[model samples]
Target: MPIPDGPTTYRELAELLRGRIEGGEYPPGEKLPNIEELMETYELARQTVRAAINQLASEGLVRTVTRKGTYVQARLGRRRVRRNHVVTRSRAGMYIFPAAAYPDEPWQTHGTPHRSMEAAPEVVAEQFGVEVGSEVLRRRRVMSPEEEPPFQIVDTWLSPQAVADAPQIAEKSTGPGGYLERLEEAGHGPISWSEITRTRMPSAEEASLLQIPGVLPVMEMILVGRSGRTEDALEVTIRVIPGDRVELVADLVRDASAQWPLRTAEPKE
Candidate 1:
């Protein structure tokens, strides 16, 4: 068999394949040619074809399955992330609730939390109202979406006392409602929480974990959850969300029943 001259560079091959996928030549969910087939058809080197497919994967345009083949990636739905749930906007904010970001249907992503003991960082200590370098429980969790690769990472720091009281918090999954529910059971029902948000390019390690393109920026949120009027926060949560499908919201309303924190203040001149 004779091979026709084709694009010589991986970039050129990637562009050609990208055009075909986007132009419906390959179609969504359609299996792309294997490495050998791609190399034979394009008359390109094996490395060149592999590199091209990898490029497409990085762009979220295709997915490769083990023992199977690479297929065109379907458009992914954006996840909802209520900024309010992440943190309260004002002092009057009472009660902390989990941000319901996804549909009521079974959640697609499950998180595996890794726990360890570490000295509290400056920021974390300030939020927890503890001395810097105080011991704390650090829980790092990475989440995977169903049938897709991992896309999010989270970190939660708690006062060592809190963890000691709720040993289940150290488990990878703390049953339904997760850590928050466990905390509540341990007598740390959060009355309120606050958050700060930042957006920036991912670190090399973060980019690798999330499998996001270098150009894509991620949202970093710092959330502090408190119970009653205690100056010591029960936990501080940090969420790293990649991609654009997220919303942050906070509601500041005074509850008539009870108020330990977020006191009403007089207007200043």
Candidate 2:
């Protein structure tokens, strides 16, 4: 195919290349045009072409080898997360609830979870309605699909009251229903969850662990668990996942005013 037009900016160059990759012009595992060729075709400078390539790499669309050219990365399967009810039961135990969404797709915690009492970060403190640097119990783990690279880094922060009431939460395994169940047993029953999501670039550690490029933005989901008894939030969970690999599904309910009917005026004569 002929080069249609030259891109003036690096972003434009990236978009053009992205179109080609998504359009199947450059199939997965196929090497993209070399920097020199792309520079010539787009009438762009080497720096601009490199920047474009870097952007694509950050978005997980392509991979660059040490000596070989950049190749298109395989399209990853997207995982859907139902926003309303994320947890479900399984024979093994209670998990964060992906089974109902994709029962056949196997997922598990990637490594040993690290738990400690640490100073709360600003965001965590805000969610817990505590002062920054206040002590909180933190549990960090990497959750991934079986036989696949890590995709999510989860950090569960618990309030002091929660820990005091449910001492079992500090153990390596929280029996059966997981932390939520434990909280319920401690009279913090009938827990309600609310979540807020935002996107930001990953940290150095996150990028390394997730095997994603630094430029890629990740979706950070902050979920708060509150007890029916009190207004205070009992637990906070921060889930970070690659933006490209996950889809969030939520059900929207309409109010009575939105009900469909013949409420419109008649046509003018």
Clashing pairs in 1: 83-248, 83-249, 84-249, 84-250
lDDT of each candidate versus the true structure: 0.71, 0.82
The TM-scores, one per candidate, come to 0.54, 0.74
TM-score top scorer: 2
Query: Residue 55: error of model 1 in Å?
Result: 12
Model 1 TM-score? Answer: 0.54
Model 2 per-residue lDDT tens digits across residues 51-138: 9999998879986765877888777768776756555556765545332135477778887889998899888898788899998999
Best lDDT among the predictions, by candidate number: 2
What CA RMSD would you report for each candidate? 9.7, 5.0
What does the lDDT come to for candidate 1? 0.71
Off by over 4 Å in 2: 1-46, 63-72, 80-83, 86-101, 264-269
lDDT, residue 99, candidate 2: 23
